[model samples]
Target: MRILRCLKRTPGIGIFSHNKSLIQLKAYIDSDWATCPKTRKSITGFSVYLGESLISWKSKKQQTISRSSSEVEYRALPATTCEIQWITYLLHYLHIQHQQPALLYCDNQVAIQIAHNQVFHE
Candidate 1:
């Protein structure tokens, strides 16, 4: 199985304070299959942030093989979108005003098209 190196951060490591409130966030999701001796299925992983602060992270094996890189990325979208929606709602519920239509950055054009086109899934 071919593995793709999806580095979450730049090479330099740094320390951060934990007591501060998180303001901004970023996320990265990727997959790897090279080390697994059994099923040989790739694993998907993600890292999340709060402002400049690291908040949450995850890594897991995919339930099945993705047909392409775009497919793998597509599979990751709903999960990320749900997280964004939850965060947005939380901010709103707390009376924190945020700019509308929160920005989501994705590299897959097909995934972006699918997100904008309601009929694609049908």
Candidate 2:
């Protein structure tokens, strides 16, 4: 496969490093509106990191169709939040102190506004 060939050609490297002093969690999320031609479902993708090291990530087709791009991006929040929550609990179990709250970054402005507003919008 092309991926395997690229990996073989590239030199081995160690990039991730542990930093006990700063144990902050962050998640980046995005979604494509109506990417699937057949299902017409948006694909949600997210990556979770701990102190600059990637710890978790996923990309999958949404179970339900989203009418708007903002809706699609909004749907991604729960999954990313759940993953971050699980990681936080895991860190707590291991007695790793994470004082700062996890940050989520999304590209869509409407999605951000939707998340901020408490009132429901159809």
Candidate 3:
């Protein structure tokens, strides 16, 4: 109740906060590997943004177990990718154009290596 009251007083990000003209969509993804002790499944979370505007975000527990933190982080990538694609499609339908490829931000080095094809296996 106290937290809710505090949240109510704070204003959310407006449609156009810092950049008003155009918003280049990007995303950030993270996961807590083996967060659930019983199932050993991870908790995946992602946030989607249009330039500086936060358009969407969610966090949920995954159903599958992962052997490594990188594996769990890798699993989170596809969901984030799907979100980026969907947002891109919506932008296109709205006739908005952005030159940059959707940027993905993450922390796991092994997952980044795999994404760049720098390493075959962990």
Candidate 4:
């Protein structure tokens, strides 16, 4: 309602890139474990940037209660990864060439280790 009206009237809000030839994808993800006292479910949030402009973002509560902070952070990774993958695929479909790998940033060290550990995959 009011938010839509504001957006319609807003200026300089759309994605603008000075250099379209060099587009990069980057993501940041985080989660807060058991932030809701009633449900005890964690909240996962992520933002995706295309070069200097933000293209996608999400913030939602986890479907299940996470036992640990690491678990909650781990849960957030898949969602962000999926989003980055989707964007990559979309770029490919649009015939846009972004050769470099997408970078994902997360604050949880334990979760990062778990993601990197080969043993966890088996």
Ranking by lDDT: 4, 2, 3, 1
lDDT of 1 by residue, 1-122 (tens): 00012223533443353655445556766655433568655666666554665545667777876666667666777777677667666657768564435445667687677778777562
- What CA RMSD would candidate 2 show? 6.1
TM per candidate comes to 0.57, 0.82, 0.79, 0.84
Write the residue-wise lDDT of candidate 4 on 46-103 in tens digits.
9988787777889999999888999999889999999899889877986978878999
After superposing candidate 4, which stretches have Cα over 4 Å from the reference?
1-14
Worst 10 residues of 4 by lDDT: 1-10
* lDDT preference between candidates 2 and 3, better one: 2
Give lDDT per model, in order. 0.60, 0.85, 0.82, 0.86
lDDT for 116 in candidate 1 is 80
Whole-model lDDT, candidate 4? 0.86
Per-candidate total of colliding backbone pairs: 1, 0, 0, 0
lDDT tens readout by residue for model 2, 13-121: 4335565536899899999999999989999999988887777889999999988998999999989999889888878986978789999999999989999999987
Residue pairs that clash (backbone atoms under 3 angstroms), model 4: none
Clashes of 1: 1
